[model samples]
Target: MTLNASLLKQGAACGQEGVPPPPLLLSLLDSSHHILCVSHVSPDGDAVGSLLALGSILRAQGKRPTLALQDEVTSEFQFMPGAEKIIGPAEVAHSYDLIVCLDTSSIDRIGTVYIPEIHNQIPLVVIDHHVTNTLFGTDNWVDTGCAATCQMLVRLADALGVPLSEEIAFSLLTGLVTDTLCFRTANTDTNVLQAALRLVNAGASLEFVVRNTLDSRSLGLVRLWGVGLANVQMEEGIIWATLNAESRQRSGVEPHQSDGLANFLVTVREADISATFAQRFANNGQELIECSFRAKPGFNVSQVAYSFGGGGHPPAAGCTVSGSLQEVSARVVAALRELRRQSVDGDSG
Candidate 1:
């Protein structure tokens, strides 16, 4: 069924209340034919979930949509419906009526999937929840208040008059569950719970999502965590760990598998801030460090990340820097120390 403009307006008023639908987005979708959809590199739950759910929504609306990602979906997220259908940058065509960039803060976050030579002429639409979004799209729909981009898609689905199918509900719920760490994040407000409730009511299983995502971990990942913990260091209320290439190879865990280390470190009673520095290689074959940071409530980490040319929320953020393991870890740790000091001083002031 085509979107009923009056019904959409009423639904936005009564269902979403203060969060009205973007009329321009609606108009764009209505006019578009074939579309290209993409998310960030190193696809996370929110990235994969939002891309697949949006693809399903567009297909339900009878529009041909192509889903693309710069990185392969990790094994953990492969269970998500439509995960197998996602194409890589090599397969993306040079033409599309429109491009939908989801859950990414900047154009570079989309990685190689976005080729300026081929896609510069196409109108870009960015849908994201990051406070650090660069607004590098012809139309940007960024809602930092939303816990996840999938939540925004829930509202978009309502505006498009597309009923939430089982697949769409599952995809959306996966993003909500993982990004919020099963609703444990500080940002898990009433709106987040309400959005999750609607997805559950539509046929997504909370238990299933938790079991597959937050609860599931590989033996190698457990070993990797152990390695990280073994090298843990703390000073001045900031705790951190390093995962070098040798440690990672010995542990036999994929790079993405170590994501939760920083989150785990922040749980220490003595730490108000936490960081994890993992050695990685960039596209140019140069050594770089991927730094992930987490802050306890009332402490902001995004500013530090932004200073280092990265971006995220107040509670969590990250950046990539060029350097050896020791060099990067020392530099980032010093930065985190200053950030913690500033936070304490602000509280005192």
Candidate 2:
């Protein structure tokens, strides 16, 4: 069933009160038959949740949907009902009626899974919640005001007249909880809570999702954080840390285990901005530093990340730089300091 304008507007405004969905988004979905859905590389909770939720919703509507991701679904999220259905790039077909890209800011974020040469003929739909989104789709529904892409999908489900099933509700709620840190982020509003409440009422276990996502972490991850904290630094209201490959090895954790260190560093009482620089090797064996940034309320780190060719929300963002950890850290820390300086000066002005 096609969503009327009123329903589209209501669904789009699910989180932001009066905002509306793109005029053509609902129509695009209505017209499509087979769809291929993909999220970003290094799939996070929001990415996986939105991808699986949308896939489930489409299946309920009698459409064939293929869910693809460039990275593996980390063990933390594998318990979700449809996690096993996700396929890698090697498994993707060359044809689809449409391509729905979820939670990704730019086309490149899909990695090699999206082949422009093969998939270019398909209508590309971009659904995301990143403030730094590049608007790189034939049809784009980017709602930066929404806390997570899954929040946007909650609206989409409403538009499609699909009631949230138990699986869909659980997946969507996982995204909302992890992205908002259980409604503790600054962007958490009545609408976010309302969406979450709906999911809870639909049988999503808030306690279960919390226990699996935010409240749970491996001992190795805790050790990684300890190593990261040992080298932490703070200057001009900015806190920073570095996690080298050796530190990852010493902690007996994978590279992504250091992901939460920046978030932890941002909790420092005196700091408004936090950053983590991690040493990694590229496919070509070249050394690189992955930079993750997080800002407290009223500060935006997305622009800084955008300047380095990465994208994200105001409160959290990231970019990868090709350089030694020390060099990249020094350079990025200076840039973050400048960003903090500008924001502080602008606030006082």
Give the Cα-based TM-score of candidate 1 against the true structure. 0.93
Q: Write the per-residue lDDT of candidate 2 for residues 139-187, one digit (tens) a residue.
A: 7777877899999898899889999998999999999998898899998
Question: What are the per-model C-alpha RMSD values against the true structure?
Answer: 4.9, 3.7
Give the residue spans of candidate 2 off by over 4 A: 1-18, 250-252
Q: Tens-digit lDDT track for model 1 on 1-349?
A: 1233443333223223335556666777889989999998788899999999999999998999999998899889998878999999899999899899999888888989899877998878778888788767776677777888898999899888999998899999999998898999998999899999999999999999999998998787888899899989999999999998878877776666677998899999999999998887766989988889999998889888888888888898888888998998898889889988988999999
Worst 10 residues of 2 by lDDT: 1-10
**Which runs of model 1 end up more than 4 angstroms from their true locations?**
1-19
lDDT against the true structure, per candidate, is 0.86, 0.86
TM-score of each: 0.93, 0.94
Residue 131, candidate 1: alpha-carbon lDDT: 76
